[model samples]
Target: MTSTTPRYLRPGKGTKVANAFARGVTKLGISLWGSRVLGVRGRTSGQLREVPVNLLTHEGAQYLVAARGETQWVRNLRAAGEGQLRLGRRVEKFGYRELADDEKPAVLRAYLARWKFEVGVFFDGVDASSPDETLRRIAPGYPVFEIRTA
Candidate 1:
C-alpha cells in the first residue's frame, strides 16, 4: 500500500481547532458551509475515526476532497471502502471510489471554488479559475473521492 502520508502531513494547531469546531457544528446539525463529520474505520485498528470534511457537490454528485492531502481519514476511507457522514443525529452510510488523478480536475476545481479561501494554501495557489492543466498537475497531491449513498 502506498503511504497516504503527504509531505504536508502535519496539521497546525489552528487546523486542529478549526476541525474541532467544525465537528462540533456538524454534531449540532448546522453544517459549516457544507462541512460534515466523516467516520471511517481505521485499517489497522478497525476503530471508527472521525474528522471534519467539506462535502462538495458537483454536477449533481457528491464528493470528498482531501484538502490536507493524503490524510489519515482518506487512508481509512480507502481501506474501509465505506463510511458514514454525520450531521447532528442524522448519519448517512455511503461507499466511495477514489477518482483517478486525470479525472480529478473538475471536482478539484469545484472544491476550490467553494473552499479556496479556507484551503487554498494547501493547493499551492490553484483555485476554481485555474486551468485544467494546473489542477491536473497538482491532482496527485489531493485525493478526490466520489460518495455513493447506501
Candidate 2:
C-alpha cells in the first residue's frame, strides 16, 4: 500500500482547551516546542480553518505529524496541498507532500521522542524507543507530511 488513511480522533474537552491556549500563545509568537497555528483552506467553504500543530524537525528536514490522526486540518491539507504556519505577525507559507506509511517510521520516532509527553497518549503506547517494526505497525493510523517553507 502506498499510504494508509489515518483514523480520526476527536479532541477531548481538555485537549480542545489546551489547543486553544497553545494557539493563543502561538499567535503572540510564543511557540511551545515548535507549536504553530496551522491554517488551511476549507475544502468546501474555501475559507480558512485553523488548528494548532507541532512542527517536527528530524534529519534536518521538517514534518507535521497528525498525532491526532486524520483531523480536519489534515484532510484540508491533503486537499489544499499548501497552507500557512502562523506565529503572530509572521506567516510562513508552506507546501507539503504526505509521506507514505513506509516513510513514516523514522519521522514518527523523532516526533515521539520530542513531544511524547504532550502527544504520547494519542500514539497508542508507542514511544520514541519503539522499534522500526513497532513504529511501522502504528504508522497507518498516523499521517505524516514533509513540509517546505516559502
Candidate 3:
C-alpha cells in the first residue's frame, strides 16, 4: 500500500498559504481564549515582550505549550527562560522549562481537545489517527513549557 504523506511532505503554493493562515488564526485564538498573560524578558537586552497563552493544568500545576513551535512568542519565552504569568487579576514570575518526551503526549492531547476545530483547519491533510495520534500530528512542532514558582 502507498503511504499517505504529511502535507509538509509536499511543499507548494497552497501549503504556503495554509501555513500562513494557520499562524494568523492561532494568534487570534490565543488573544481571545487564552486566560493568562505572559511576559518574557529579552535574553540579551532585557526587554519585556508579552502575550496571552492558554494556561493548562497537568499534575495539578499550571503549564503552557506551543502547539506549533513555529510561534515567535514561544521562542521569546524560551530565550527568556523565566517569565511572569498573570491570570485574572493575579500575577507571578516563574521559571520555565521544556517538558521531557514522556510528558508531552498527554499535554498535547489536552491542548488539541481544547482547540479541536481550529486544529483541523490549520493542520489540513493530517491523518486523524486515534484521538491520540490526532493530537501528536495536530502540530508537529509542539513544545511544552512548565512554570516554576517564583
Candidate 4:
C-alpha cells in the first residue's frame, strides 16, 4: 500500500525564523521545550550541519524524530551513524541506530503526544491517540533514531 506520509516539506519562512530562535535559545543554555541543536557530519561535504530538533524521552530512552521527513540532517545522520546534540556549552556525542519501519509506531506515538502542537501537521492528522495501524502506515516517512551516548 502507498504511504500517506509526505515525502518532504521544505521549510518556509516561518520555520526558518522558528529554527533560528530555537538555535539561539539553545546556544544560550536555555532549552526551549526540550529543543536542542543536532549536529551531524554532512554525508558528502564532510562538514557539520546543524538544525533544531525536539528531544523525546520515552521510558528513560532518548529519541530523535525527523518531523520534516527525509530532511538533509536525516540523510546525514543515516550515513554518519553518529552526531552531537548541543545545548549551550553542553555537547553530547551520540551514536544513532535507525529504527525499522515496524519498530517506529510506539516511538512515533509518544513523539506526537509530546510535540503534537508543534509538529502534528507533518503527521497528516495522526496523533498520539491514533491507532497503531495508522501510525505504522506513516512510520516510513518519519525516520526515528535511538540515541546512545558516545
Candidate 5:
C-alpha cells in the first residue's frame, strides 16, 4: 500500500540534506539567499524547533510560504501563532497570520519568483510565470503566512 502523504509534501533525502546544511550554515551566521532559522515552539513538546526557511518580501510585507505543504513547522507555527526568525546573532520574534487561499497567490508568486530554482519542485508545475488562475488553483496546497512584528 502507498503512504497517504502527498508526493510534493514529502521531503526527499536530498531535500533533507540541503535543509540540514542550510540550518547549520544559517545558525553559523551565514545566510543562503536570505534563509533564516525559523524557531517555533513544538506544539506538543513545548520545545523550540528550528528549520531554515526562505523569507519572502512582497508589497512591503514579509511572508513565509510553506512550499512543501503542511509540514512540522507549519503545524507548530499554527499552534504557537508566533515564532522567531534568526539570522546571524540577531533574532526577531514575531506573530504570524495564516493567509487565506485567495490571499496566497500574490505572495506565493513573489516567493516563487525569488527562489524558484530551489523550491519550484514543490509547487508542482506552477511557477512565478504561471497564470493567476493556476496559482489560485494550487493556493490551498501551499500555506502562506504573514509575519507581524511588534
Candidate 6:
C-alpha cells in the first residue's frame, strides 16, 4: 500500500479517516520516541505552535531543521527567533536562525543521517549534492532554519 493507504486488515471506505488518524499517530510517535520538541509563541498573534523535529548535533552545535517549511512551529520561530522547547520536565528558550545556502548542506546531511527515514519530507527532494539549487528553488517559498539554546 502507498503512504496514502492506511494499514488495515482490509481496505474499505474509511481509508481517508484511517490514513489521517495514522498520520497523526505517526507524528505523535515521532515526537514521543524522538527528542524534545518546542512550543513557540507566535510573534504577532501569540499563538502557541509545536512540532516534532529532529535534534541533531553537528560539530558540537545542536541544531534543528525546518524540514517542512509549512509547519507552524517554523513560522513562529521565524517570527520570534526565540522560543521555548520542552522535553519531559525541562524547558528552555532558544534563539533560531534560518540557515543560508552555504550552511545548509552540512546541516541537511546531519538531519538526513539522524532521521534518514523521513528524507523525502525533511530534504523536500533535496540531496547532499544539490542542496544549493534546492534552497534556491525553495527560497521564495520554504527555506530551512536552525535553532540554538538561548
Q: What CA root-mean-square deviation does each model show from the true structure?
A: 2.7, 2.6, 7.1, 2.0, 2.7, 8.9
User: What TM-score does each of the candidates earn?
Assistant: 0.93, 0.94, 0.63, 0.94, 0.93, 0.63
Question: Which one is best on lDDT?
Answer: 4
Tens digit of lDDT per residue, candidate 1, span 59-130?
A: 999999988777899888888889999999999999988899999999998898998899888887788999
Better of 1 and 4 by lDDT: 4
Q: Which ten residues in a row have the lowest lDDT in candidate 1?
A: 1-10
How big is the positional error of residue 138 in model 4, measured in Å on the Cα after superposition? 0.6
Better of 2 and 5 by lDDT: 2
Please list all clashing residue pairs in model 4, or write none if there are none: none
Q: Which segments of model 4 are wrong by more than 4 Å?
A: 1-6
Candidate 3 local Cα displacement, residue 71, angstroms? 2.0
Instruction: Supply the TM-score for candidate 1.
Output: 0.93
Candidate 5: the clashing residue pairs are none
**Which lDDT values do the candidates have, in the order given?**
0.90, 0.91, 0.62, 0.92, 0.90, 0.59
Which of the predicted structures, 4 or 6, would earn the higher lDDT when compared with the native?
4
Clashing pairs in 6: none
Question: What is the number of residue pairs that collide in model 1?
Answer: 0
Judge candidate 2 against the unseen true structure and give its global Cα lDDT, from 0 to 1.
Answer: 0.91
lDDT of 5 by residue, 4-43 (tens): 6542477889888999999999988899998999999999
Q: Which whole-number lDDT from 0 to 100 does residue 63 have in model 1? A: 98
Model 1 Cα displacement at 73 (Å)?
0.4
Higher-TM-score candidate of 2 and 3: 2
